[model samples]
Target: MPARLPYAYKYLRAKKKFPHVWCPGCGIGIVMGSIIRAIDSLGWDLDDILMVSGIGCTSRMPVYVDFNTLHTTHGRALAFGTGAKMANPKLKVLAVMGDGDSMAIGGNHIIHASRRNMDITAIIVNNNNYGMTGGQFSPTTPQGAKTSTTPYGMIEPDFDICKLTEAAGANFVARGDVYHVIELDGMIKKALSGSGFRVVEALAPCPTNFGRANRQGDAVNMMELLKDNTINIAQASKLSKEKTEGKTVRGIFVDRDEIGYLERYEELCDRVLSEVKK
Candidate 1:
């Protein structure tokens, strides 16, 4: 038998939850494993963590994890996560969303959440297209990339999720791909260990739809592409522009110290009570 991972089993549902609905070689499972390992490495209590997700392939994460899970409507993961964080203030809300779920219909929600510095972690698994909904082009689909809806080729530029979240005032922002499991785990763990609106964009491969549409070959081909095309932030800094051109840069982009939404809310409440008593 393969060596058992106690940490993984401690937080994940039993083997009865097997036969997940993702494609045979989909990278969402890698992302999920990274998440599970991150949570385990952090030694966090399962009761204190609230894993929330919107409708999509990545959204199915909550169904498998043994946490306080909320499988919400499409494009509303961050919205619901914000409310949950506000209501309890103690729960560690981790919103797992797809690119389409985060940037397409729910674009404004992430922006406002970061603006408010909400103490929640957004794990965005970006597969370039809508995997579950027939491989529609998402906001993160690369310009000139092909998708089910973009048969001729996508005409618009993709949103650099790290830059967008960083500019929007998230205390932590980072990018990781499924091919680099260790870095992805570190990014997620570091994001979870902090306050403010943290965001980790995990670029994964949607082999079934995205690959077939774009002629990206099989799962191995896509994963190999990720390995060859991505460069770490540290490594990228030392390389010249010509050397780094067209590479998908990965690593922690922003990690700033800022007070979270709940902290501000608590302060306001305390101040109001003090004024009333006085």
Candidate 2:
């Protein structure tokens, strides 16, 4: 059936059984497809992979994939992933989180984990507002944007995810929206192959809740917003915030070659062994 679906389609099949819980036209599916394709491209063992997620609509991703996943509490996926990596040291841990999950409640863990440069890949689905939580204004929601919590218009500032992660010491940081499917796939693949802490913030859409609440309408309209409102780093640098208007910065923002957290720990262990032997 369907020509046995190629070996490269391993991760894509899960969508069939799970169907799509996200609203039609929502970009979470697109982002998920890109992630699976990336994993397939890397030829990583499904058995050796662990997909951990925190609370939210995006966090539900790990459940649909056919990998060992831990759907943990809100904002705790990174911590759990860190422990898992430290224990096994062989498992390829991927933490799937939401904007609020990683930037708000879990912000501390994110920065500390980045500082430690753990051998883990973190994929953050940033749909601006909290889709699962009644379209509330999240840490990344643009200033003056309407949300459940800020119906009159938000007055607070937003966190540029890429810059924040890079400054916090993440070895690798990248940003890709659902609109850029190929780029998303490549970034995810690179992050997984990387040695130290990696973060990929995927700008997704919440057409049903956030879209309607913010007057952005259905999924198609939301996608159009992404197309019109996102900017690349090169483009962003040339333009001022006023010129960018409603646009956001997209694309890979940082990448560093450094010793992974576990690798360094192993080195420490080896040194202890050598000293004892002497």
Candidate 3:
């Protein structure tokens, strides 16, 4: 008889609703696996977790996983997730989006969600360019990067997803790359275990679209780039500014204790009831 697979496969082992639509070597699949393993390690009931996604390459994640899922319009995953969390605070809500889906069209929704500090965990896969609609430059695409839309090289600066969310007041914010799978898993698990709005900006490679346009070679080459280019927060503190220049920082940037939206809403409802009683 064949040996049994690890416990985490319990999630993947059960439901394969469809063949994943992601391209070979696309890191979105790795991100999805990290999510599943993290959730499994946490032992959260699948029924109580609500996975939501917007239109994009990464947004197709919910199609394969066995969880309560909602596939919404482009730039609206957070909007729908916020409503679900408000309606049923007991449910664990997770919003998955690609860099383009969240940072471009859904920009306002993410900012408001972070400011609202509601109970939601956002997993944003930043593969530089838009993978689904075309290899177009996105808000997170690096300056001077080549893409289908920016043949002359992108001119504008890119938005740092973690920093943006932190400034917007998310309770927890972290940056992780698909190359660091264990670290990514830990970050996602920590984000899931927290309250208020949390965001995990996952830097993944889009070898199919983004990579092809930029001539980043295959998925292995992109993974090597991640390994060399990113440094963790702990090690970064010891390095000089010049040494770390042009390198990406990965790890938890913010973790704070703050009241979530549901508690405030409940308090208002109680106040209204007490006023009527009087």
TM-score of each: 0.97, 0.92, 0.96
Local accuracy of candidate 1 as per-residue lDDT tens digits, 1-278? 55875657777788677778899879998989998888888888899999999999999989888999999999999999988988898899999999999998989999999999999999999999999988999999998899989999999989988888888999999999999999999999999999999999999999899989999999999999999999999999999999999999999989999999899999999999999999
Could you give me the TM-score of model 3 versus the true structure?
A: 0.96
Candidate 3 — worst ten consecutive residues by lDDT sum? 8-17
Full ranking by lDDT:
1, 3, 2
When summed lDDT is taken over every stretch of 10 residues in candidate 1, the lowest stretch is 1-10
The TM-score of candidate 2 is: 0.92
List the global CA lDDT of all models: 0.92, 0.86, 0.92
Worst 10 residues of 2 by lDDT: 8-17
Please list the residue runs of candidate 2 whose C-alpha ends up more than 4 Å from where it truly belongs after superposition. 6-9, 12-17, 234-246
Residue-wise C-alpha lDDT for candidate 2, range 34-62, written one tens digit per residue: 78888888888889999999998888887
In the range 46-141, model 3's lDDT, one tens digit per residue, is 889999999999999887777899999999999999999888888999999999999999999999999999889999999999898778999988
Using TM-score as the yardstick, the better of models 1 and 3 is 1
The superposed Cα distance between candidate 2 and the true structure at residue 74, in angstroms, equals 0.5
Please list all clashing residue pairs in model 2, or write none if there are none.
none
> How should the candidates be ordered by TM-score, best one leading?
1, 3, 2
